[model samples]
Target: MMSVPNLDQLDANALRALAAQLVGELEQRDRVLDETRQVVAKQAHDIQFKETHIRKLTHEIAILRRYRFGKKSEQLGGEQGLLLEDAVDADIAAIEQELINLGGQPSEQKAVSQPKRQALPPELPRIQVRHEPHSTTCTCGCQMQRIGQDITEKLDYTPGVFSVEQHIRGKWACRQCETLTQAPMPAQVIDKGIATSGLLAHVLVAKYTDHLPLYRQEQIFARSGVRVPRSTLAEWVGVCGVRLQPLVDALREAILNEPVVHADETPVQVLQPGSKKTHRAYLWAYAPGVFQDLRAVVYDFTDGRSGAHARAFLGGWRGELICDDYGGYKACFEQGIAEVGCMAHARRKFYELHQSGKSLIAEQALKSIGQLYEIEALSADLCAAQRQQLREQQAKPIAQTLHAWMMAHRIKVPGGTGIARALDYSLKRWAALTRYLGDGRLPIDNNWIENQIRPIALGRKNWLFAGSQRAGRRAAAVMSLIQSAKINSHDPYAYLKDVLARLPTHPNNRIEELLPHKWQPSAA
Candidate 1:
């Protein structure tokens, strides 16, 4: 260490310079301290935020556990019970994953032991897969002898058949090396997964297409001589959903490429974060026009029925949109997207009035609308040009006469009456309603998309609600491919299996080839 000089021995100028140096050192020290404090504060804040998140997750898990194990009255019956149990299993899995992500351990629950399983059916075909040692020679140059073998059987399912995969692993050991060797396990869609691609496909098709929940699948698998846990099945589903997202993205782009597209939205319930309750979410479906050769539909899931979601999805793709008069789409129309209204919506208003059996005007309106539908039926088999010609010749006159008759009747009816409101609905949107007459490619109603949404509606009765927003979107993506596969007359299970098997190595730029419309099953 250097020795300090006496202050009295120094000159006045030197003393002043010394004071300046001291002041500079003090400022530098202060700056360093300030920076250190800022870093510590940030770290503390981060730790607090993480702790809060962990507590919230812990609370959610507890609630789910209670619901899963609580009262019998809370439980449902039949198909709904299966769906609810599956949902609980999925939610628990999802929460555990989140906990793991947060650097926390998943709370352990004791597994309930199951009874002895029944033997598998004798009629089902069994495929043997032999896993043997690559080499019988040891490091010491001694030949190894074949010892015993272990055989494990896993039940696998194809669409309509159940098969058993007999995995035979042979044991080989050398006395010199004192080592045993067996062939390494093959890679699968899920690492160390007992499920085969065929089994995975069956689960997916059953869940997404058949709308059978995971718990139901669990029971089914149990019946087949294996008791696969619902949690494991949910994990597999999550993995498949992630793997299949790229294909869904490609499908969305294809749907948007068409000149005329069908757009519609349906409500689905989604569980809100950190709560036991759920909120309404919308699944917006888009498809190419009925006349377009591309037979595919894509679904987008949004947390709300906001027009912004539609605008974001459509993203400057100026095309004719066939949809009902929902104000959510008004913004889209204002942005220069051509709106082709559903004639069915207009007819429904009059149909409702006629059903009331109180309005002659409504009956007249239905007769006129019926004439329009008859024209559409006649043109169904015709080419676009011929269909348009027929529409202009036949349907246009009827629509004009209907418009004139409605105007004449409106003056005779009271302002707030049902018939008056029905008339206003048709007249106010007459241009959009009649726009389909000029283009044969446009559908007469939003029924095509409505039909596409029908399966989702039916599925809601079984599965009840989506577990979360991510789950909703995942459901939408998988359903898009499934429904699109059906639209193209391809088997959904075959399509999904082939795609899932090839997805890991399938070229990203050429992902469109895996789409339902263009996909061809592999020869192998």
Candidate 2:
């Protein structure tokens, strides 16, 4: 047998060279492992995403079902239901009209170009004046001839805008005689605040509604020859919240009192109360109804991504919580809260799974789910009783079949496989998943809340981060009111303007009527 060479016989230099080579190989292997880990993580994320979307779609379907079939109550009385039904019918009508318009457009029309604006007129004439001593002088030695007629030009400008002027005619009489008194102007959003109700409303709209930063607003004011300090604007926003907090607090109480509520959370970077740099916080949004009308959407802020933060905001309340499939909400479930997932979240997963050619299984599952939604669509304009009847006759069977298919496919699937993971998630949450079919009040998904939250996400791209935790809370509160107003088909800026104008004088005892739903525009 050949003897193996011993390391003891090798020189120090040779051994050192071999050790160096081994170290390099080990480093390369480690790098490969790290890369593999990242890929695995991304794959896991993609799978979870598909599962989440399925939950979203399911929640949305439930909500549509309730709106279609739920019994009339104080929350959704006769008038509101009719309004909701009309809205849905109008949407369908609009969609059908749009399709017709799209089909009517000719293929050749795609080549048509839009007309451009006309350019400004070129110079027509030049006016020049020359003073010269000439023989045409009348009395003196200097003479002048007119090259063109001397004319006076009137400067054109926009007509000065006039505002309603209130003349308070107060009369006084002798002490022994009869007396007369005049009423004071109504209180505004700001107490003795320099800005008018309209101006404060404009500032709030610019900062919150339009997503313009205070510094940028200052620059805009400067362009208009008005000086508005950034610090001052920030103070106004803070003060505005303080004045509006009573309304927000009332709205939150109203929202919590509702049978069903929608919820969502988004990340916000807030400057720590005392720290030099900003910290990550969450803006938790809660809305009372799927369709906004009188619904209250309240936002709460917290310093961390813990379930306790969510629980604190929710308190001892136990209502149907509509949200995405984030594990963070699992704690809420443990705390006796009901969790309703979103079908949109589930659809999103399949959509992502479809990106990989391996999504055929998920696609099939989605088709069945789509059938459930279609059944709900049939009851869109029907009353709750009628909708319940249709669900029993139509939707119940589809849901039963869908549930069976998910179960049958569950066993054969791999624990970690994409489709298997989705099946497991749905099956595990099956109780909540199927709860919507039984109750007319629960929504199928949280898409309505998600849609409301989306605008803030878009604004975040430009604004990047909030200046402070106080700032984030302010943003959430204002956005809640603004988005709620938008959902009611009311102009957010106009509604806010009106609220700021009347809220001060509006009685605290009748605050609920001042809530977005009961608010009506009175002649200014």
How many residue pairs collide in each prediction?
A: 0, 31
> Which residue runs of candidate 2 sit more than 4 Å off their true CA positions?
1-186, 273-276, 291-294
Whole-model Cα lDDT of every candidate shown, in order: 0.82, 0.62
Worst 10 residues of 2 by lDDT: 153-162
Best candidate per TM-score, number? 1
lDDT by residue (tens digit), candidate 2, 108-163: 12112212322212221222222222233333333333332222211111112112
Global CA lDDT of candidate 1, please? 0.82
User: What's the distance in Å from true for residue 314, model 2?
Assistant: 2.5
Clashing pairs in 1: none
- Displacement of residue 247 (Cα, Å) in model 2 is 0.6
Candidate 2 at 282: error in angstroms? 0.7
**Model 2 TM-score (2 dp):** 0.64
What local lDDT score does residue 193 receive in model 1, on the 0 to 100 scale? Answer: 62
Which window of ten consecutive residues has the lowest lDDT sum in model 1? 110-119
- Cα lDDT tens digits, model 1, 255-334, are 88899999999999886433456689999999898888899998899999999999999997999999999999999898
